[model samples]
Target: MAETPAADVHPPYLYPDYKSTRLRAPAQPLVRVAPSPLDTAGPTFPKHFVKDSEADLTTWGKSAPLGEKMVLVGRVLDEDGRPVRRSLVEVWQANASGKYPHPVDDHEAPLDPNFLGKGQVLTDDKGRYRIVTVKPGAYPWQNHAFGWRPAHIHFSLFGNAYAQRLITQMFFPGDPLLAIDPIFQSVPEAGRRLLIADLDLEHGVEGVALGYRFDMVLRGPRATPMGV
Candidate 1:
């Protein structure tokens, strides 16, 4: 994709490890957009940021079983490993019964009028975005004979309109189905972790406090030579 110029556009927040990292915004958006933005992600194209916001998606019904509660926490960074503050991140997931809120979810769960089963995160300078939500139930897909999809979440990360965007999902570890799923295996092994993050294992993270850590990576400008 053609590179956009950084102008009035806003960036997202950057983050680091357990240790603290800088939380600063750029003078403007680093990329110049076209008519708008690249939009979504698939196997064919690479996105500026790789994400899986679905981990936090849990509707009232037609999906997974409802529990005490849950939370989704993650970070957003650029190719250079910096936060892209002011960027928008969206995620959606099924309810405890494995059904979605929309009519498309023909599963068994009921619709959660209170719970949208979705959320948005605007990054800070440190690239961190967090949400409090419930764990979603496993749903059905056309992947196998029985066609049961592994427990997963869907994510949509946005950069400056014209720049590269991403749409991807995340799956929990130890899921037996990933071994046979073609799409999960499509991502390069090195980049796979970019989508699937580790679970936060604090004392009170489950029951009413399940903690999920998801990170995203967005494409940034080409490295400018020092002389320039």
Candidate 2:
């Protein structure tokens, strides 16, 4: 049995700064359960299930979604520094106006009729994935008086089995709100930097869109912090 690494790169479940965590974090120690054969052997997604076009969120609508268009590209790697090929990567984000299309989002910003704000793609043989999307906008939240969330994109990744799922968020470079946002502050200072993507001019399509790179390490001392 391999020992689980210390969750030094992950955020605490009960980070007081993130007020909601206080109400939901387990008060008791988590119980451990051995995985059954079923838990470790299934839940695979077929490549055809996710069409290549599904990876581009900006093209889904009848017309271009309004916002700064950008491309996000990166690789998914395991703790051993090897690619986790063909993994499923899903992303969701608020529209350019900082409003989600869901009914629960009461933010006054107008939703983009051309942008559903969600997309998914399977990593290639080298664990590389790409997404074309508009840069999300900052939105007001009730976490604190005059609170607002920084622009960010939510990411969900799944390994060969359901047990290998991980969820996190990606932010852009030099976002001012990041310093004051409680959710972003929950992670340790060292791990916090991993959540921010880097601007990569080489990946940018000339005059088409800017490019950002955000790689995710599944686990290890250098693992990217899990948002949840």
Which structure among the candidates has the greatest lDDT?
2
All candidates: CA RMSD in angstroms?
Answer: 13.2, 4.6
Model 2, 1-228: lDDT tens digits are 111234466677777778898788877665556655554544678879899998899998899999999999999987777787888999999999999999889899998899999999998889899999999999998888889999999999886554567899999899999988989898878789999999987797999999999999875222432221
Can you write out model 1's per-residue Cα lDDT over 1-228, one digit (the tens) per residue?
221333212212222221122344233444543331233322222333434443344443465445446666777776666666656777777755566778666776575655666776666567687766666677766434566666677878765433446678877766786665545554446555555657776623654576667777666433421110
Model 1 regions more than 4 Å off: 1-65, 203-207, 221-228
Q: In model 2, which range of ten residues has the least summed lDDT?
A: 219-228
TM-score of each: 0.64, 0.90
Q: Which ten residues in a row have the lowest lDDT in candidate 1?
A: 10-19
Per-residue lDDT for 67 in model 1?
Answer: 49
